[model samples]
Target: MTTWRDVQAAAPEFARRVQSLFDAHKHKTIATLRADGSPRISGIETAFTDGELTFGSMPNARKGSDLHRDPRFALHTATVDPVEGNEAEWPGEAKIAGRAVHSGSIPDGPDGDLFRADITEVVLTHLDDSATLLVIEWWTPTNGLRAVERE
Candidate 1:
């Protein structure tokens, strides 16, 4: 497991792009494993602060329970349909896959809880400037950063 700061330190430019995509939106989506091992998607918001990726959930939220039971999770930036004629201008989307570790309790009492992200992968997908190719970029603790482009 790697800290968010590790990604930043290993690939500052890549981290910047991913963070910008996340910061561009307030609401994101997270995928957690249900008890049956099925994938569960939930709406969430995360912050990159204090060299950590942090998120909170309501006291009785199912997503919170899922993370407690299985820390493995995936998070993606909120996305919008690209404009028909301005696809090239689309800023693209980002995703993060990792574990959520119980870091501390929420400040507003036991109404919720806070967790830190232990990242494994960070990905960015977008169209090239020419809008003729789709580019996929990813970073991992084991591989650093790499990318591929497709028509």
Candidate 2:
């Protein structure tokens, strides 16, 4: 399992950009697997602190149950549509796919359950400076960062 710190060490600039996009919004989304192996998408918020990525769920929340039953998850940063004539000002959206590890028990706390990400991949997608081609970049624990531009 790779930590967010490991991703940072592997690709600092990419990590910084990814984190910025996450920080730009207060809410994001997460995809978890259901008992039937279908996907359940839910609204979520993330924290990048203490050199780790973390999120929480209300007690007995479906998402929490999903993680416990199946740790695999894909988290996405909230996105804002690019201004029609100001595409260059739109920061790319970011995504992270990995397993969710129980950070710890709340133990009489009101925050419900907390989990840390064991990242496998992080991706950023945006338009090029000329706002023509789309640029997609991804970083993995083993592969580092790679990019491709598409028209």
Candidate 3:
């Protein structure tokens, strides 16, 4: 697994783009595994600080509980609707998949649970200028960055 800092160091431009997508919105979605191995999606806010990607959950929240039992997760940046009849205007979407390492508890009043991401994969998808081509970029600890375009 790689930290956010590792990605930045290996692929600065790709990391920047991914970070921009995450920064463009406030709320992101995190997918966790349920006990039965099903998927559970939850709204979450993440912080990229001190070279780590982290998030917190309210005490005993289902999402928190899910992570406690299964640390694997896929986090997606918030989606923005494409402009009417102008799909090219869409800013695109980003996703990070990894395992969460329990980092401890939030220092403040509410006693939230904190987890740091151990990113294994990151992806960004967007469209070409005419919206005729789909562009997909992906990065991993070993692979760094690679892109693909399709109609």
Candidate 4:
């Protein structure tokens, strides 16, 4: 499984941008599939440590149960609304999609469930320097980093 460190080694610039977004805030969003295959979004905090992205859930939390049943997940960085006239300064957003592999248990923390991410895709979206185009950079295990710009 590819770790966040692997991504950093492979695509440092892209990884830096993505990490900056995650570092800009503490609260992020994680999406998991429900029993009926519907989408469920949960507010979560993430940690980048020991070459892995980790998060936990309270005991018997629905999100924890969902991950136990299905590891697939997509995590998004927190975002701030752009100023009315200064939209160009917006820092942009980042997302990571992958599976959560059960790592172990959380110690002294409500006996919560812990999981580490196995990254499959990472993406960053932001305004270009001129702020006239939207720049999207994405990275995957096989394809590596790729970028696109749109008006």
Pairs of residues clashing in candidate 2: none
Model 4 clash pairs are: none
Which lDDT value does model 2 have at 87?
Answer: 93
Q: Model 3, range 4-121, lDDT digits (tens) per residue?
A: 9998898898889899999888999999999999999999999889778888889989899999999999999998878889999888999999999998897665789989999999
Once fitted onto the true fold, the runs of candidate 2 whose alpha carbons sit more than 4 angstroms away are: 106-109
RMSD of 2: 1.5
TM-score of every prediction relative to native: 0.95, 0.95, 0.94, 0.96
Error of 2 at 8 (Å): 1.1
* Candidate 3 stretches greater than 4 Å from native: none
Per-residue CA lDDT of model 2 for 1-151, tens digit only, reads 7988998888898899999999998999999999999999999988888789988888899999999999999999997899999998789899999999987765444768999999999999999999998899999888889999999
Native-structure RMSD, model 3: 1.3
lDDT of each: 0.92, 0.92, 0.91, 0.91
Of the pair 2 and 4, which is ahead by lDDT?
2
Q: Tens digits of per-residue lDDT for model 4 on 23-64? A: 899899999999998999999989888778899998899999
- Mind giving the per-residue lDDT tens digits that candidate 1 earns over 3-116? 889999999988999999999989999999999999999999899997889998888899999999999999999987779999999889999999999876876545688989
Candidate 1: Cα lDDT at 20: 95
**Candidate 4 ranges with C-alpha deviation above 4 Å:** none
Question: How large is the C-alpha RMSD of every model relative to the true structure?
Answer: 1.4, 1.5, 1.3, 1.1
